[model samples]
Target: MEHVAKTRDRITLTGVRVRAHHGVFDFEREAGQEFVIDVSVAVDLAAAASGDDLARTVHYGELAEAISAAVERDPVDLIETVAERVASVALAFPAVEEVEVTVHKPQAPITVPFTDVAVTIVRGRA
Candidate 1:
């Protein structure tokens, strides 16, 4: 058999806010904070576009809910872990060929002033 590279269309969900306790510090875990999540999935959309069926495409509403659950339900020390978990969930979808996840911690316990702290990860099947 021969192999062919496939090009995928992207579906993105940005700025998904959730309240969660995820941190190494005790104070952080005690006082939960709002987390921002962003997710992007790559998939073939031709079938969905032509068929105009919900089953043919990955549902953004469902995907967003799943991602929010991952962030809120589980507490981890690093945002990297959160990003990885989110990517795994996205990749599990049949329509998703690849996924990229970003977990943002805006209210971090930092002594200096900063905009945000985040971790981004990309995962896919070859």
Candidate 2:
């Protein structure tokens, strides 16, 4: 949930690659696959920018690690659930007001040829 005030400034992390086991099939869970992720978080950056303080703004490096850990920690059947988990992690940061998460499965077990399969979600304080 979004716990922060409305802000135009945002931090974005794109194309994070991770190996994870997330699928409906047992084979998929056993084999695992490479997942590409994208995350955008909205936050107020004026204080941090003006004061040159890291504490007042979202730390993207930590955010990336957190999202990666979130994806790696659990096994789920749907990317939607993965997106929610990432959103929760981003919003847990004090400066984050909103978050958008996209989970990409490049090697999904689809019968037909496809470039990628992904789920995107946006969350804010309730």
List clashing residue pairs in candidate 1: none
Tens digit per residue, CA lDDT, model 2, 1-126: 979546889899999998999999999899999999999998888999999999999889999999999999779999899999999999999889889999999999999989998999999977
lDDT of each: 0.90, 0.92
lDDT of 1 by residue, 1-126 (tens): 999676569899999999999999998888989999999999889899999988988999999999998888768888888898899889889999999898999999999999999988889976
Where does model 2 exceed 4 Å of error? 1-5
Minimal lDDT window, size 10, model 1:
2-11
TM-scores of the candidates are 0.94, 0.94
